[model samples]
Target: MPVNRTVNVSVVFNCVQNGANDFGGSATYTQSSSTPSDLGNVVDSNGNIDLRQASAYDPSQYNDSVDFVFTLAPQSTGYVTPVVWASRNGAGATIVVPQGGNAQEFQVEQSSATPQLLTIVDNDDDSNTYNYKPAVELPNFDHYYISLDPRIVNKPSSTNK
Candidate 1:
């Protein structure tokens, strides 16, 4: 039997005062188990977590989960709490964290093999309103793309006398 696996991702936000007042963010991932690794570091050369690589999994083999933890760096000025959303293939997005919510961490259960995309935005404007639409291009928001390739492994059947 395969054991369950968990992936931990750390998120950091930075506010840049580039005349236009821009925000920058980054994410990195680490797996819990190394014996049967199902995922790589997931961080691209640009120091961003891009899971669209070879993140393959087999539901029948093991259950996989991912946790995204957010952190506001000291340099992230004029920024309030963080809110998150998830969507697939340019469809409508679902709120993972509501505005002004006290939760700083969100959990994602990997049940489907299809690809997914998550967006994390800071409430820099301190507004209580939000639009849960995919690819809306909100300021101070970062995208974490996930692509899970399903792998089916066949097991040998047992023969009884």
Candidate 2:
């Protein structure tokens, strides 16, 4: 027998200008399959993506897993392209990681457009830094998810260095 498969993938950028402020513009792109077709029908002028999961997931129903979160910030204006890779214990959560809480959560941010690529590298590897490697693989009977957020960090209150 032979195996063939086609994966239809899409990404939605929840764009914002500065901390939590709306961009006051709209983005035209296809939303991820995790979202419904009719729901993500509009990317409002406020730069808000309408695609949202209607139901809540029960964490207790699955095994231990990591939730990768990527927040991208662009220097100026250009189409934003993002990528994601997953692995076990690949990265750290600088904001919220309780002493023994869910170490499964990890977060990273790309503050400038200069660094066009964001790669997750494990501590063990020392070569080929550009490689997009996942520290862990999908676990059996476990649930995992990725949260991609695009926002601008520059605000009027920012100071020049």
Candidate 3:
């Protein structure tokens, strides 16, 4: 049997020049009592989070979910709004905005083994121009990107009772 894993990620954005140039952002996995071991080791040295079950298991049997919490520096708390861009292989993943929290909180559910890219862009002036936009509109700075690559371990046998 496969298992469902949950990973919590904390995103911090430092908006400089009102998110114009030289803006910086980072994301790190947050540990909690309910965090799964597989997802716990998700973060790599390069800061890329890959959703893969280390144990030998079939990918089809498991689903990985991520909870993202976004926070901006005090200077840009009300000035900049971060946007999430899930463009590469994004169709295989599902994004949900949780209620009760500010606009920065959201969840991502991924069931496919295909790799996907989620980019967080700092939206200054609180404009909607960057919302749900394509990758081509992504700015060069003041943003962070996370790579999701789910790996399949064992293949399920075709013949079954």
Who is ahead in TM-score, 1 or 2?
1
Candidate 2 residue pairs that clash: 87-135, 87-136, 88-135, 88-136
Give the residue spans of candidate 2 off by over 4 A: 1-26, 35-53, 62-106, 109-161
Per-residue error (Å), model 2, residue 30:
2.3
Name the weakest run of 10 consecutive residues (lDDT summed) in model 2. Answer: 152-161
Candidate 1, which segments miss by more than 4 Å at Cα?
1-4, 18-38, 45-61, 64-161
lDDT of 1 by residue, 52-103 (tens): 3325556466444333222212323443434232243332223333444642
Pitting candidate 1 against candidate 3, the one with the higher lDDT is 1
lDDT tens readout by residue for model 3, 28-84: 323222234443454333234333322332446543323322221122333254434
Which ten-residue region of model 3 has the weakest summed lDDT? Answer: 128-137
The prediction achieving the highest TM-score against the true structure is 3
**Which candidate comes out best when scored by lDDT?**
1
C-alpha lDDT of candidate 2 relative to the true structure: 0.24
User: How would you order the candidates by lDDT, starting with the best?
Assistant: 1, 3, 2
Q: Looking at candidate 2, what is the lDDT of residue 127?
A: 14
